[model samples]
Target: MTCDRLVCANCAAPVNEGRCPVCRASRERLQQQEGVLGALTPAALLVLLVALVAVAVLARSFAG
Candidate 1:
């Protein structure tokens, strides 16, 4: 849920534009909340999928 597309109810404008104080504050809060997980791009997801497959293979081999 990024704030880039959020519409501010205070001024009936886009939050990213910061049309009002409430919109700016809400945008800032959303940005801070997404700071951590927001950086997980497609490449990171691909790497994580590969790691999961490798782990699954190892687990199956050990079980057998």
Candidate 2:
């Protein structure tokens, strides 16, 4: 999803290079996107899932 590897359809060049107006525009748009979540890693997602499970287990024990 990052612009570094994207090719510009208008100029047939890499978006990161900004070889043309179209490339520059596209790169800018991609950069403005939200943080690493827009490109989440599997490890991070796994950690989040584990945390959620732990919270649910703790809540159940407390209620019992």
Candidate 3:
């Protein structure tokens, strides 16, 4: 649940836009809880996953 999809009940706007104080505070809190990888887009994370799999496959091949 990224902030991008969150709705601000106080401002009636998307949380990511932070239209009001409440929205801003909520966005900040959510971002903090999400950590570093949580900020990454789905596509970027997918690429990372693929890269990790490739690395593991290469490592296994080398070890054998």
Candidate 4:
């Protein structure tokens, strides 16, 4: 899960703030697990999907 709204059990603060050692470690781990696609926000992915669908539909219509 994203750390922005995560409440740290150790510090009782947002994990994004890295308010404690646990928060910092968790944040680091989350960052390490993320790659190219993970970098895209939900909205960005949705837009990309819509664009792909549009391209597919247009291509199919032209082909037939």
Candidate 5:
């Protein structure tokens, strides 16, 4: 649901590029909604996700 993947109906361009006023506004709104955590790069997010999964697995094993 990132703005990079969003298509602008105003200019038929990606919202992340900010090609039009609408795109820029939309991008800004999305970034704000995401907050500090959403500012992270895709790679960082993936690493965090993997770490969380590993923790979940460990916790499950310990529980059993």
Candidate 6:
């Protein structure tokens, strides 16, 4: 989950704001753990998957 959407239990505030030590730690941890595709939204990821499948099909058709 993104820090902007996360609520900090320690400070009862948004984690992105880093209102307390817990928020800062959690935010840092989340930032470090995000992977290459982590930033992509679900819709964006779905579009990318569809494009990749289309490319593979085109490549196979051209090769055949």
Clashes of each: 0, 0, 0, 0, 0, 0
Predicted structure 4: lDDT: 0.92
The 10 consecutive residues of candidate 2 with the worst lDDT sum are 32-41
Stretches off by above 4 angstroms in model 1 are 41-47, 51-64
For candidate 1, write residues 1-64 as lDDT tens digits.
6776889988999999898999989988887887776867878979999999999999999999
Candidate with better TM-score, 5 vs 6: 6
User: In model 5, what is the error at residue 3, expressed in angstroms?
Assistant: 0.9
Lowest-scoring 10 consecutive residues by lDDT in candidate 1?
Answer: 33-42
By lDDT, is 1 or 3 better? Answer: 3
List candidate 4 segments past 4 Å from native. Answer: none
- Top candidate on TM-score is 6
What is the model-wide C-alpha lDDT for candidate 2?
A: 0.86
CA RMSD for every model?
3.2, 2.5, 1.7, 1.4, 4.1, 1.0
CA error at residue 8 for candidate 2, angstroms: 0.9
User: Which 10-residue span in candidate 6 carries the lowest summed lDDT?
Assistant: 31-40
TM-score of each: 0.62, 0.60, 0.74, 0.81, 0.59, 0.89
**Where is model 3 poorest over a 10-residue stretch in terms of lDDT?**
31-40
Candidate 3, residue 6: Cα displacement in angstroms equals 3.0
lDDT (0-100) at residue 9 of candidate 6? 83
Per-residue lDDT, model 6, residue 54, is 100
Candidate 1 displacement at residue 29 in angstroms: 0.5
Superior candidate under lDDT, 1 versus 6: 6
The digit string of per-residue lDDT tens for model 2 on 7-51 reads 889989989999999998888888778476866667988999999
Which runs in model 5 stand beyond 4 Å of their true positions?
40-64
Clashing pairs in 3: none
User: Candidate 5 lDDT, tens digit per residue, 1-64?
Assistant: 5886899999999999999999999998997898788778899999999999999999999999
Query: Residue-wise lDDT of candidate 3 within 9-60, one digit each (tens)?
Result: 9979999999999999998898789888877889999999999999999999
